[model samples]
Target: MDVGLLLLSAAVLIGAVVLTATSGDRRIARLDRRLARVEQKLDAIAAGVGVELPEPELGHVKALLAEGKKIQAVRAYREATGADLKEAAQAIDQLGT
Candidate 1:
């Protein structure tokens, strides 16, 4: 292929990637907002019913951290809190610090 044709093809590929990423980001952001609203509503309902959310126990996770087993700590945190992988990892990292 000619240099000009190759350059055009590359530009098109890059544009497609950018478009896909942008749309995906927007969709994720939208979902996050929706989730926040739902959580707020749930919180209000819980408060109205005098229902209290219990704090998750992280003793095992802390023990794992003390043993220098970060991955296992994250796993334990996730199991304890039902947090996603990233949230669990971040929480474990914060505890380590």
Candidate 2:
């Protein structure tokens, strides 16, 4: 009975390790794809709006987005630059990449 329990515990541990490794890889891939999309959107906005941004402002926007404050960042950008929410989000997204 003790041997059976030890085998079961070992199997469970191995399963857990495999699951953890796969999940981490999937998360990284998802983040990369998201960053790519954000970069594309940012480029489109820059071309369409013709708004030139300095480096510091871009960094702040990127930080806000990374912290998951998307709406707040968009609103702040709008208030600061008089750009609309969509435009601000695009600018912020661009900063993230």
Candidate 3:
């Protein structure tokens, strides 16, 4: 999960490609499979770290808050997000008047 580790992995993969381009060893001749594996790894990393989930709808929660019903707003947030009491309260608190 470290940025340095990710950069090192990319650098190593690039170095391998460059080495394959210049070297003549028969055993290390091709990079197609290796590149595919690197692509898969990069895809997995992106899925885990870069993907963004959409926020839950909060129109009803906002309406409740506008009506000065804080408790009902927290309950709406909980139902919308499936968050527990504390989490919903904290989230609704962040959306201050």
Q: Between candidates 1 and 2, which one is better according to lDDT?
A: 1
The Cα RMSD in angstroms, rounded to one decimal, for candidate 2 relative to the true structure is 10.6
Stretches > 4 Å off in candidate 1: 1-3, 85-97
Whole-model lDDT values for every prediction: 0.95, 0.81, 0.87
* Residue lDDT tens for model 1, 1-88: 6999999999999999999999999999999999999999999999999999889988999999999999999998998999999999
Q: Candidate 3, which segments miss by more than 4 Å at Cα? A: 1-46, 49-51
Q: For residue 63, what is the lDDT in candidate 2? A: 63
| Number of the top TM-score candidate | 1
Model 2, runs deviating above 4 Å: 52-97
Compute the lDDT for candidate 1.
0.95
Q: In candidate 2, what are the lDDT values of residues 5-97, reduced to their tens digit?
A: 999999999999999999999999999999889989998999899977654354565567789998877777777677777888888777567
**Candidate 1: pairs in clash:** none
What lDDT does model 3 reach?
0.87
Q: List per-candidate RMSD values in Å.
A: 2.9, 10.6, 17.8
Question: What's the TM-score of each model vs. the native?
Answer: 0.69, 0.48, 0.47
Q: Which ten residues in a row have the lowest lDDT in candidate 3?
A: 24-33
